[model samples]
Structure formats: C-alpha cells, structure tokens
Target chain A: SQQGEEDPQALSIQEGENATMNCSYKTSINNLQWYRQNSGRGLVHLILIRSNEREKHSGRLRVTLDTSKKSSSLLITASRAADTASYFCATVWNNDMRFGAGTRLTVKP
Target chain B: GAGVSQSPSNKVTEKGKDVELRCDPISGHTALYWYRQRLGQGLEFLIYFQGNSAPDKSGLPSDRFSAERTGESVSTLTIQRTQQEDSAVYLCASSLTSGSFSYEQYFGPGTRLTVT
Candidate 1:
C-alpha cells in the first residue's frame, strides 16, 4: 500500500511562477524525500527532509515536513518549462519506502 | 560512472506467459528496490534487497511475482502466468545502504511491460 498521497492531481502555471504541491501520509516516518519524474519513467531525487528537520532547500526547491500532521510540501520557485513533470513524495520508515501518486505539473512557456 | 540500469526498456508479452525484468545497480551500493507503476497511478512497492539480509517480499501482490539478487550486484523480477492487469512500468533503484532511511535512492530507466 502507498504511504503518502499527493494533492492537486494536476497543476498548470506560467513560466517564472512558483508551484507548490502537498503530500499527506498515513503513519509515522523516519524521513521524507521528494522526487521528480519526467515522461513517467526514471525519478530524480530532489530534496530530502528528515523528521527532525522542518524545512530544507536545494537550489530552487523548498521542502517542509510536519511529522505531527504526517504531511509535507514541495515548493519550486521561479519555475521553468523544464520543471514540468510529475512530483512525488516518498515516506521512508525503517528500511522501507513508499511513494505517492504524484502531482502532474505543467509549466507553460 | 554509470547509474542503475534495467534491461528491455519495453516489453509486450501475451497473457499467461512468463516475463523477466533485470536490474543492474550501481557498484558498491548495498540496497536494491523494485516497484510497479500502472498507467496514471502511484508506484507500488514490490520488494527490496538490503545487503546480505533476507529480502522483504511483503509488498509483492501475489505469489506469481518473485525477485532475486546476488550479493549487491544484479537483480531480477520475474512474473509468471502474466495477467493483463499486470501491465505496468517496473522501476529499479539502489541506495548506498538501506540501514539508513536518510539515504537518497538512485533510480534506473524503468522497463515498461505490457501484458496482452
């Protein structure tokens, strides 16, 4: 079974606009990581936020995690057409990890 | 250096036939994972192999599915008596270690399997 569930099954935005996606999980997690998939294939690791940390940033990506709420959000700033892809949240517990359904984002140039 | 690799970028098989998907994880990595994603759906965890410990097969949907890995090198996922509902993209990933949940996984270009 999937642990996390991403909201806003789809989103559309213009270039340079910021895009935000939220994910909610069911149980406790050791860490939460976000990934981006292009053409529904390989997934590229984006940012990882541990349960101890609340927020993290990598380049243009910002991630925030709230263990109490069992939720996390990924914010991409100054989005570009290249940023258009399916974003997923994976919650890891112990040695196991489960991914969400993913939010399909489209950045119009 | 090369990343995780999976063979047969795409495969179409007839129902009731058997198909095998292969994965070659990055060298020195001690953790391997397999997942299945149906069209327009979330990825479903299949199984994982962490170093020498026994593989975790709890996520496998049925007994028709099985996976094997030798040490930390290569892995294969085999599905017997394939069904149409089994069509999905199979993804493989590897991490430096599964002992830590903080390690990011490196993914391979998934193999798309279509059972007709």
Candidate 2:
C-alpha cells in the first residue's frame, strides 16, 4: 500500500514562474523528504522537513508540512528549464520510508 | 568522494533464470537500502542494512528475493527463479546513518532489470 499520494500527476509551467506540488499521506510520519529525479538517473535529495516543522527553505525550494492535515507541499520558486523533472515526496515512519507516485513538472523557457 | 554506485546499468534474463545486482555504497556510510520501481509507479521498499546488525528484510516481495551485505560495504541482491513480473528498476541508496530524522540518502543510477 502506498502511504503518500501526490496531487496533479503532471504540471507544465513557464520559466521564472513558481511550481507547487502537494502530497498527502495516510498515517503519522516522523519526517517528510522531497526528491527530484531527472530522466534515467538517480534521485536527488531536495529538502527534508520534520513532523515538528511547519515550513522549511533551501535555495529556491520552499516546503510546508501540516501534520494535522497529513499533507505537505513543495514549492519551487522561479522555476527554470533545469528544474524539469519528476518530484517525489517520501515519508519516514517507524524506520521505514515510502515514496509517493510523484509529479512530473515541465518548464518551458 | 564517490557516491553510491550500482553495476550493470541494464540487465535482461529469461524467466526462471536467476539474476544478481550489486551496490557499492559511499566509503563510510553505514546504512544501505534497496527499492524497486515499476513503470510509472512509485518506489517500493525492498530491504535495508544498517551496519553489522541484522538487516530489515520485511519489505522483500518473496522468499526468492534476498540480499547480502559484506562488512558494511558492498551489497548484492539476488533473485532466484525470476519471473516476468519481477522486471523493474532496482535502486540502491546509502545514508550516513539510519533514523527518521537528519539523515540524507544518496542514490545510485539504478539497474533496469528485464525478466523475459
């Protein structure tokens, strides 16, 4: 069973715009981490937010977590063509990590 | 500093045949994990190894699927009597340590396994 499900399976945006992807999970989690994967490559760690944290920022990325809602959102500010890839949200619970289906983002320059 | 590395970027084997995949984690990382991703699907946890302690094999799909780690370094995943349904991209990841917080995982390029 999948613990996390991401919204908007795919999104297309223009360069310089902000792209937002949301994820929701079924159970409580210790933390949530976001990862990006380019075509035919390994996944790159983006950011991690603990259950106690409501928001976090790293470079152009902003992540928000709502424990009560069992949801999280990742925002990429000033998106670029280089940001075109698949983004995934994974949850850590009881020493186990599970990934969501992911959102495919395309940035048009 | 070398990142996690996996051998045989792609593999193809006939049904009922066996296959082996390998992973070499970062020099000093202590935690390693295996995951499987099917076409257009999310990653599924397969197994985890933390140091010399017993590995967490709860996520393995079947008895035919087994993994071994040597001295907290190289690890190999073996699939016996493979089936077509076992085809997928197998990914290996390693982290400095294991816990729910503060540890970041580095991933390998992954092995695309095709069981015909």
Residue pairs in steric clash, candidate 2? none
What CAPRI class is candidate 1?
medium
Candidate 2 wrongly placed segments (more than 4 Å) = B98-100
TM-score of chain B of each: 0.96, 0.96
lDDT string, candidate 2, A19-108, tens digits: 999999999999999999888468999999999999999999999999999999999999999999999998888666778889999999
For model 1 chain A, give the 10-residue run with minimal summed lDDT: A91-100
Best by TM-score: 1
lDDT of 1 at B85: 96
Top-scoring candidate (DockQ):
1
Report lDDT (Cα) of residue A80, candidate 2: 98
Model 2 in CAPRI terms: which quality?
medium
Per-prediction DockQ comes to 0.80, 0.65
> How good is model 2 by TM-score?
0.94
